[model samples]
Target: MGKSKVYFTNMHATIKENLPQKLRRLIKTAGIGQIDFDRKFTAIKIHFGEPGNLAYLRPNYAKTVADVVKELGGKPFLTDCNTLYVGGRKNALDHLSSAYVNGFSLLSTGCHIIIADGLKGTDEALVPVKNGEYVKEAKIGQAVMDADVFISLSHFKGHESTGFGGTLKNIGMGCGSRAGKMEMHSSGKPHVSHSKCVGCGTCIKNCAHDAITLKDHKATIDHNKCVGCGRCIGVCPMDAVQPASDESNDILNKKIAEYSAAVLYGRPNFHISLVIDVSPYCDCHSENDIPIVPDVGMFASFDPVALDVACADAVNRQSVIKGSILEKNGHKHQDYFTDVSPETNWRVAIDHAVKLNLGNKEYELITI
Candidate 1:
């Protein structure tokens, strides 16, 4: 296959012309309107940053995409799955409230919002994709599967786990329902610690699998039956549950690749990544740190894998902003995220994504 088209524009103007108009121009140039959005349910997967995380994509940008979808006669909804390791977005109710607080209200984006996973985080559909590495199927959010079209409005940034989070990250991790997340993170088990367990029964109440119990002055998970869904890890007020053992970073990266493939199997998808506020960690955190690099710009593509690769390449090319967490000063030969999180390799994710035939590793970047 030839080079994948990845269109971009720098963050030069103010939000008025810079966002809405630029989105239209970029997509039009890239032939995004050709997709059959007419009278379809279009899901625009996006991360509404946690309450204190300022690094997420702004609501105005999502509004631009939502408006464009409406113009094409699609009923657009801003969405994201309930997170696996949660601070705010563990369940649909709390997740929606977080979205509103983070400025993803219907009035802001001109569309409704839905947590892909329903109230208990167990509402999901198992899609059969017998890809070689995966045996039978991958469980994606039912609402996501029901949508006629898919779009990802990703906030491109560094992640402690993944080398950098981008369009593919937005799809693979963002579209996974709570159980899907558990499957991807299966190797890493989390158990409740009795000493820290408040015995308030919050963990038991929130657990979808009924894996946890409050008795004998503490909490216990029947590991023989524990599916390791990771919901209880986030629900404990006293921080009782934590990962039992850290899996090799390589395993985590590869799992992300496989999950990304499951999300895109049969969807008519398009993606847009905003490379702004290049934070050092995931927006799932309740707080965000200073950006390690200046805002680069925006990118759009039909290929999620290529889009992420292009964005990561763009970020790697920029010089790290001093006085931030990026401790390295060698612009000639430094990987920014790696400099910050030394144990992990982001390239593994890219290579694995390509290996799984998600998209080509070689991408040609075009500036709009």
Candidate 2:
């Protein structure tokens, strides 16, 4: 429970060593080799840029992580769960297609991609969260739980909801099953966006609980019968079924911490976050805006919580980019994430994560 070690390396690279080589060295020095990866299935969780979000970490970073795993005699594969929203990554087929379109092919990343939540986002494993107040059981992607070792290659950036999407966000929300994401973001049920609903019977056909019925060529969800499994939200062709994002920002952060506990508890896990392209919104968005701050560098740690804090500190230390949202917001809160996103306080997640015994908030930032 002392100050955890967070190793960092700046973005300055020379002809002798490129960025990827630098990343490899950073992770190695961060004690990634301490894990016993001999013939184990290692899951390198990452976001494959939402098709057009150029701010997402490039596949080269993933290749570096995967190659290190392979060199350690581990079977490594890049994995991410299907998104809850209707997007290019709502199902396994579309998800894989989007990943390929974003240049994450095995040919490019030197590893295969697995949509952890399966075709319809129902392939899940129920995991119990220890000392959890917000969530007792976390519905996680089955493939993620099946892995023997876990590694997060995250793009540390701004988020509209939780402030910053870092290591915990990548593991908790990114690895969540469709239903898991629902539990974190909402009251566990989806409502039909009447304007967007074409009365497409897709949700009706896919609802196992028969909670959906078409009325006047529009889908109406029967809250009484709804199980809050969030299948309707995923299968809606027009993206008509929407999550009721009613959870408070603080509660949302706590739920993320609990979900993260479900994934990392009793497991060998490592984390790496790239503090470049500090966009003001999540990579889940199809488009990315200009970075709010200059690219800091890369960070690695055994402690996901500490890694996140270190990254946030590094970002806050840098001057805001001119014309960026952070500058426009005027730094009223003196915190970059909250300044960019006034409604969200990223520290809620950090404090909740610390309370959950995830890792120490205090960290020694070691620049290499």
Candidate 3:
């Protein structure tokens, strides 16, 4: 309906205040104090970059947010669900180790880390999506749904599949349990990469539905029996099991919006996105390419959709970095994200989010 307020601050720092201190001021000015956080359990949803990815938001930013929450008497913890793809963060133990390696310790962030979906990524909460078209009940991590308040501390960057990974992508796809991620990414079941499969029978053993069977030292999935729960993908040591990416980017974006609604429904939520680094691919990748554009800044909002739109607009106005992916690809679409990723359309998520009443696309940008 009406324009939501999105607060912004440039990365320029004075001698009086550094980036983290500026971040603290930004959120407070944006009215994070409006929420009564007295003794409430708060989940600060974030991506603790894949092991080698340097594009993720640093732990110092997370500490600034956590410190503010603590000032208001809230108990906050950094949380993220296990990733669907094979990486250092596929399971809880590996995920925590990666977070620590990436400088997200309790000492650094002033908050503990919780792998939302338990040890193996199977633990989940079935959350009903109101007015959902693609998903009726969203499978989110149990711990993420258990929080009294939700805050997304996102690293805004380009994504290969969903156009760009912003607040909605961080909350929707990041909060999903293994099965929930599978549902958002694909309409069908997973298949094994014949070359990578070693016939280790790991997927076969983990599949409760008996959908996977090894034939001649290679695994094959029976889609008829497979329920698409995504358990096999996590259990495969060789990373041979791959989820079908058959869902169109448009449908995938809508599904992500629905999943986000499911996570935030009836909960007090806040969002902050840092548009620095501006990588051409997701932080899920172990290797990050050069930024597509110069760093925009930090943004905070009560509305996730509006926050994303504001960040996208800010990036679109900036000049492209020389020799970066955006420059190499050329600005055919005149949109920074599309110039970097031609196949994706970030607007799909914003439109779907508006339709779901999650947030407004229109926003008033207030410089802090």
Ranking by lDDT: 3, 2, 1
Q: What pairs collide in candidate 3?
A: none
Please provide, for model 1 over 73-105, each residue's C-alpha lDDT reduced to its tens digit, 9 standing for 90 to 100.
999998888877647787788899999888889
RMSD for all candidates, in order, please: 2.6, 1.1, 1.2
Question: Which candidate wins on TM-score?
Answer: 2
Cα lDDT tens digits for candidate 2, 170-223 = 999999999999999986578989999998699999888888999999999999
**lDDT value for candidate 1?**
0.79
Worst ten-residue run, lDDT, model 3? 334-343
- For residue 60, model 2's alpha carbon misses the true position, in angstroms, by 0.3
Score candidate 1 by TM-score against the native. 0.91
Q: Which residue segments of model 2 deviate by more than 4 Å?
A: none
TM-score of each: 0.91, 0.98, 0.97
The stretch of ten residues in a row with the least summed lDDT in candidate 1 is 128-137
Which regions in candidate 1 have their CA more than 4 angstroms from the true location?
14-16, 132-136, 200-215, 230-245, 328-333
Please report the TM-score between candidate 2 and the true structure: 0.98
Identify the leading candidate in terms of lDDT.
3
